[model samples]
Target: MAKFIINGGKKLSGEIKVSGSKNALFPIFAASLLTEQPCRISNVPEIVDKQVMVHLLADLGVQMNVSPHEVLITAANINKTDLNPELTSKLRGSVVLLGALLARMKRVTMSFPGGDSIGKRPIDSHLQAFEALGAITQANGVIEISAEKLVGNKIILEESSVTATENAILAGAMAEGQTVIKLAAMEPHVQQLCEFLNKMGAKITGIGTTTINITGVPKLHGAEIDLIPDSNEAASFITLAAATKSTVTVTGINPEYLDDFLLKLKNMAVNFEVGKDFIEVNAPTVDYQAIKIQGGLYPKLASDDIPAMAILATQAVGKSTMNEWMYENRLGYATELMKMGASVEAVDSHNVIFTGPTPLKGDKMTSSDIRMGITLVIAALVAQGQSEIEGVEHIDRGYENLEERLSKLGAEIRRA
Candidate 1:
């Protein structure tokens, strides 16, 4: 029930270090179950979703040592094969354990996963991939999967689902013979997982391509890995700088991962300079023109970043069209922007047209999802009066010390 009180009309100016990738850490944490030895993961973000994953691991009898930015996981004495429904229902990433559990114990049972209500994010792809890897899946309110010696085969994903691709890789890495995955998601996180698996004795090739081949290994040993920085979070902060006419430097960013997003920001006339490990974005005095964005699997505007762009468009000069073909309910949070005087109309479940340079006046609003919650906070920082954002737990599930970081950049915001 925590809320954020933000006083508006302040230009944010400072440098803030970015946190580890939330998306990367979840699958990596699940991957720890693939080995009985201790797997040490660094750059772990201290966020709510991470805590949920840690709790789920504990429920499965894995010993875990958690710090602010590091985690040590030992799965030697894992005595349980099933995840608790009550705990697994807390976050969408909980579904990631299915592949790991099935690989280790040949069975997994869990209820449907839950998190941000962005839309109908079905796990059919995950189930489909599991079935493709010689596992039997039963679905009702809860899903039950079991296998007797997973044998690898060719898997062409119905969609380029990131989680499903990760699950298949995890499951395939331990299966007998070779497994080939086609039309897989080629996101940076997916590539990171493939690299980590290769380091752990699993033979994986084509790390950054749509087609991945995994050769099963009899056993995988523990290895140390540092996760890539959270590119989505960095993009959100860059959009904030552009919206509020601020200058902010984000450290710990990977330039290669941000190439596509930076180009899009450049198209909007936002000034930026990229370093080897950092990127700085400086906002303009006058509002910029609207930009069109389309979402795809990779090398496209991430669907998670659409809400942030929607908020940034409110400060732009003309109409902006955002086509979020990924999720349906993602645009629902735009109503909160309307409360702040933004002229955003949901053309359909998958599209929104925003007309702006609208004078935003702060109001009380609730966060609907992780990215949208952060977007609302960005809007609150640039809006006219004081604004209160409820459901801050959603924001905590992703960003680390968001208010503190923004405050360092001269924003007037505090957690209450």
Candidate 2:
């Protein structure tokens, strides 16, 4: 087990280049199974989740060449119909392969997928969409799905679930007719998947909306795609800048996705400058005001991000409420901040109220999930004295070389 020992009270100041979207790259990797040709994915993050996905692909006889930031996958000689359960259980994105396998081999058998224990994330939405498109599903302990042919039909998703919507689109892209998806997830990663499928000859419209239309293609060819930078990771850096009262530049961000979120942070008196492809966040000198935030589907603060925001709120002077409506257990990580002397109270499982300007003292902490783990690290950077953080694997599952990146920004953090 790896851990991070952070010597706190350092202002992070420097430029750090952001990596490709971990959320975007996983689905795209699974989508590679839809083609038998070679696919090149650039800007891939060298993280545990990506490694798990690559291992799963290799188990299916797909050849992969990986570097620090790029992956090339060729699936011309797939040899297995069953995905490795152990690998699949390591990350949530492993469920994405169900769509590709069902599309290509007409059958797939895999165990229940697992990842961070955030809450009850059901795969029923994925199954319902698959069954709607002419596939049969069987579940006892393991899940088995098979179909002779998938004929496209209109699918009104029960909820705007991101993974479920992506699974539906992947399955419907190769179906025989037109598939109209209502109440679909319009996250940026979903849009990237749609654009990627279109490049491979699948017809898809409504790239960034609640409803999507996909015309099935008999076969999809391999295409080259550059994954987008991770906005959530970038947001973490922005929050760190604000907490430490330092100026740092985050490079290679897509401005369109960040404008609204940055604007909200600015409203809280955080200063930042946005360029075409980068954002420079300057820390505030005076006591900052806490801002109320609500999490929603898209164009709202992402649920995965609320934990980090909660940590940032501890540095402000007033109280702030973060209402996380999506996941029930996400606010549990805030308790770690309270351990560091931050006045955070969990109103319920989903809501947390923060009373700020708490003089935090470094304490031993453990990471419950990826985002929260990193949030703890951010809190440690601003706290006084030394802090030991365990469960570093959770942090590495999303962020790549986080200690190295923070060190480049002059943070006193090291791996142990």
Candidate 3:
């Protein structure tokens, strides 16, 4: 039970470089199982989720050379087709391996995957997509998926689930014929996976759209790829800057990926500048009007960023609302914020109303999930007095070396 100790009322000023997207790397790493050639991926973040993925890959006999900045994976000699429930339960990203294993070995046995206890994130889409690819699926205590030959077909996901769409893509990349996916998730990370597979010789088109067409190739050759900077992490620092009324310059960002969040920042009257690879934010002296945040799909405010926006709303001039229609437990930290003197109320399981500019007082809190965990940290960093946040493990799953990075930016925070 590690904790983060923070001395509040520090104005975070200085430049901080965000790591590569952890979310982007998860599915791509699993998708690497589709190819026999050595795949080189750079700009990987060193986080708990990545380590868990590497551990899962090791169990499957994929030789990996992992470092702080990059990862080289060659699944040419995989010996196992089954992933254990223990490792898979650690992170939900493990479910993405289903399509890859089916693509390569044509058989896979596993239990239900797990990650955050946010809600009932069902893998029905993953199994449904696999069945669409001509695979036979069974369900007992364990799920057994097998196929004689993967034949591509059209798949229209039920709800544009990201991992389900990714599973279909991974399996479709190696299937026999053309695979058409309609109502696919058009997230930046999903697009990144499409681009990576294309570089690996899979002909994928209509990226960043609702419809994705994939032409299955016989074999995929390994290629080098770089991950895009994490927009969520970039947005985290920008929210901190505004909450503390400080100046922060975050480097290593692609401005286009963060257009929606930037628009909301502007609407909230937070002065900001975007460059080729950087975002500089300056907080105004007076609190600004409330801004409604719709935590929907990509090109919209993502669900992961909902908590941070709620934290920003606590210091806003008027009433602000955050609606996370995706997950029921996304507002778990709202009660925690109330402990810190924030006028935030969980209006429903999926929505929260924040009234500000309420003065926040530091207190003891715990991380509920990755997004909510960091949001609490940002609130604690700006609150009056000392704040201790339990559950560093949850925070480490997403952000890499958060305490050290924020420390460099003048935040008096340390792991304890």
Q: What is the C-alpha lDDT of each candidate?
A: 0.88, 0.88, 0.89
Q: What digit string (tens of lDDT, one per residue) describes model 1 on residues 74-95? A: 9998898878888877888888
Candidate ranking under lDDT, highest first, comes to: 3, 2, 1
> Clashing pairs in model 2?
none
lDDT of 2 by residue, 204-292 (tens): 99889999999899999999999999999988888887877789998888867766578668767888888998889887756678888
Per-candidate TM vs. native?
0.98, 0.98, 0.98
Residue 76 displacement in candidate 1 (angstroms) = 0.4
Of candidates 3 and 2, the better by lDDT: 3
Mark the regions of model 2 whose C-alpha exceeds 4 Å error after superposition: none
All candidates: CA RMSD (Å): 1.1, 1.1, 1.1
> In candidate 3, how many Å is residue 295 off?
1.6
